[model samples]
Each structure stands twice: as structure tokens, then as C-alpha cells.
Target: MPDLPDISNIPYLPSPARDMNWRDLNRFKSSDRGSDFYKTCLDYSQVLWRQRLPARAILCLDRAWGADLTGDEPILESWPLPYQALVYILQNAPTGVFLGNPRIHFQHYADRLGEPRLEQRKWRSWACWALSCKARPDFQSDPDHDVEEPSLEKIAQKLDQYGHIEETKLWKSILQAID
Candidate 1:
């Protein structure tokens, strides 16, 4: 492919989705390209979010989450950057930015999370593990997966309980909730 377009002036770009060639983004997929691809997508997503184009930002984030060389296990258990970005977006973006119910949105992504592993197990392990806490009683259930936990609601509640907390502290609380 041609050299990556100068993304420095993302604000001035017209037709960002096309300018970024989001549809063909997966063409860059390769084992060696995973981290860089994810980081680039994350950076663009953040820029789009700050540009008041949250819907587009979400598309970028979703693509980042689907980076071809990255496995869901690494995304769930090892990748801190994606987790941090996801937490930040979930905390800051308005629910209206999501096309449907936010829970359903998460659940949808969670459902699609590890197709390779999906057929091996009757129940989803990683994403469902992350989401099946009591706080989200609405999620799909797994008999072996129920854990008393801090759900996304718990994270949001903590954020609300302590108004204007430091960014690091906020990230800590969110991680704690998900962990």
C-alpha cells in the first residue's frame, strides 16, 4: 500500500472515513503489524472523539478492537492500551453515540470477540467473563462464569461518586472494576 497519509492534520481532513480508508484498514493486517495497527487506530479514534465525531471514533475503536493479528486473549488479559482507551471512551461518550442500547452494544462486541475460540467452548470465556458481573444482570449468562464483580455500572458509579477525580485515579478505578 502507499505510505500512510499524513494524519497529523486530522482535523482538516474532509470525508475522514474515506480519507482514512477505514474499509481497507484490514489489508494492513499481519503478525508484525498488530501493535502498530492498533496504536494507529487508537490514536485516530482519540482524535475523532476530540473532533466531536464520536460515531466515527467508535468505528475506529471497533476496528482497533478487531485488529487482525491481535487475539482476544491478549486484548483481554495483556493489552493495557486498548483497555485504557475503551474505558476512557465508555466513560466519556454519550449513550446516544451508540446505535442501540449501550449494554447491547457491548454485548454485541463481546459476542463477536473470539470466533476462533467460540466453537470450542459452549460458553464465551473472556468477554463474557469481563461482562458477567452482577451489575450487568442483563448479559448472557454462563453457568460456570458467574462471579460477584464490579460491573461497568460499578465503574460509572465510582466515577460519579468522586467527582473530578484525577485521570490516573479514574483509570485505576475503572481497571479495578473490570478486574
Candidate 2:
């Protein structure tokens, strides 16, 4: 988190409005990699990501995709690719690069959220993959959905099925470290 400019020093406590700019966030000077403001924002994001339920998290994705993070187009747009990659890869759909924005098929995705398990993240990952898969040209969308709970079995099935093609490539990269 970078240093937050001293707004407290201002004479008037209230202002009608303040224009926010992202350039401030991008500004990096020398070793000023982690500013108070930047670290705060990342901490906020991490908290939000961690505490969020699967359903709510997906909904947040929807709102952000529909509109920039929280409103007027950001001066510096946020990249959702990392978020998307985390979601799809966890579900073993590493090739979901073709999955476009999930807005157009929101209902379809919201429906396929499967069941919840004690291990909550599993269903969220699967739901994320379903959304990603729906966008690919070949992976046809299916509305017949179920709320089946996710378990170790479910996770293994998804990995075995969807991860097959990428596993060899993934293992090759992993093996590189040994040599």
C-alpha cells in the first residue's frame, strides 16, 4: 500500500465529489513497490476474495464484467485474466481461454453451480469452469443443471476428465525443475 495523500489536512471536511484516478495506483518510484494505499487495496481484495461465498463471488464477477469494478470506466482497467485462470485451472479446464465474458449466459452459469460441500471452494471452481466452458465454441452449454455437492470424488473426476490433455504438458514443465 502506498502512502495515502493527507486528505485529513484539508480545511473542509466534506466535498461534493472527488474524481478517482488509477494512475495514482500505477505510479511506482524506485523501490516504492508496496505503497500504503496499494497494499491496502490488495489486502482489501484478498479479504473480499477469501471471505466471499461461491455464489456471491460469481455474482461479483458478473457485476465487474458488466461494469468496471465498481462504476465509471477505470482509467486503468483491471485485468481479470488472472482471476479467470485461477478459476478455470482449479476446475481442471486449463484450455478455457476461449471462455469469453460470462454475462450473456449468466443464468446458465448460475444454474450449474452444483452442490456445496464442506470443502466450499470446489463447487465454486466447478461453477467457474462451467461458465468458461459455456463460452467456448465447441463446449456446448447445457441448462439442465443440478446442485450436487462437490467432494474429493467430484474434484478427482473433473481433474481426470478435463485435465487429461493438459496434464502431460503440465508435468513436463514440472519435471524441468528436477533436471
Candidate 3:
């Protein structure tokens, strides 16, 4: 196995997947030269690839979730790690998809998702915690898992409610909802 191509600009995988020892799923490590994940990314990508994709960019084939589960392509910019995991949980992956590891690069999601909103931080917490539970149940025992009380619908409704209230009065309602 001669040297493969570049990093493919694929997103990294967070360490939340069943304590599998988080790997830089996007980067090709020499140690991974014999791994199936590495080979599949290169093999399938080469077939569908057109004239030229950047040396650093490869077409992603591994999805965050299976096709039946993934929703729309995740709007992953600006969000924190837990939120990113939520999107992965909501949306099913295609034949292959790129999942980024937030611990390694927290800012990437925010950068890609775009500038944050004034209330973004408020609602995102509800989502992140719920998502973390679904994706990494290990965190259920963690103190920060604040989603024990509210149902997911209630959280979404709260987020929607925040979208309507004025910023001046928003804190009152948002705080109430979070509490």
C-alpha cells in the first residue's frame, strides 16, 4: 500500500462511539493502511470521482447514521459537539458520510454552521443533552445530562417558542424553559 491521497476534508469522529478510542476517521493514518475503513473510502471514492478532486478532499462514503435514519444533510456549522451528534442521530448516513470529531475541532461546526444566534446557546443545550443520551448512553451517568425531565418535543417546542420572543424578554422564558 503506497501512500494514499490527502485527508479528504472529511469530518472527524468524536470519541462518543461506545468507547472505541476515538480515531481521526477523516485522516489516513499509516497504521490504518490495512484497515477496511481506509480502503473503502479510497476505493469507492476513486470509482465515483470525476476528473479531479482536491488532494486533500475525498468523497465521503461513511455516514453518521444508516440511510434509513439520517435526515437532511446536517446543517453542522456553529453548533457544539453534542448538537453535531444530534444531527448525526437525526439524519441517516448515505452510502458513506463524514462525521467530525468535536473534541479535536470544536470550532469547525460553528464555523461551518455559521454565526450563532443570540438564543442559539439557550436552545442548543436541550438538544445536545438529549442527543448525547441517544448517541452515547455512557453519559447518562454524567452529571451534565440535564435532559432527564423534558421530553424531546417539549424541548423543540421551547426552542420554537424562543424563536418568537423578543431578546429583551427572551431570557425570562428561555431560563424558565431550561430550568
Best TM-score among the predictions, by candidate number:
1
Ranking by lDDT: 1, 2, 3
lDDT of 1 by residue, 102-158 (tens): 334444454455543232111222222343332334444444433443454554444
CA lDDT, every model vs. true structure: 0.44, 0.33, 0.32
How far in Å is the alpha carbon of 128 misplaced in model 2? 7.7
Candidate 2 per-residue C-alpha lDDT over 20-83 given as tens digits, one digit per residue, 9 for 90 to 100: 2335334544234322333323332333333322233334343222221221223213332123
Name the candidate, 1 or 2, with the larger TM-score value. Answer: 1
- Top lDDT prediction, candidate number: 1
After superposition, candidate 3 runs with Cα above 4 Å error: 1-119, 143-148, 164-179
Stretches of candidate 2 off by over 4 Å are: 1-48, 68-131, 134-179
Model 2, global lDDT: 0.33
Per-model tally of clashing residue pairs? 0, 13, 20
Q: Which residue pairs clash in candidate 1? A: none
Q: C-alpha displacement of 159 in model 3, angstroms?
A: 1.4
Lowest lDDT 10-residue stretch of candidate 3: 62-71
lDDT of 3: 0.32
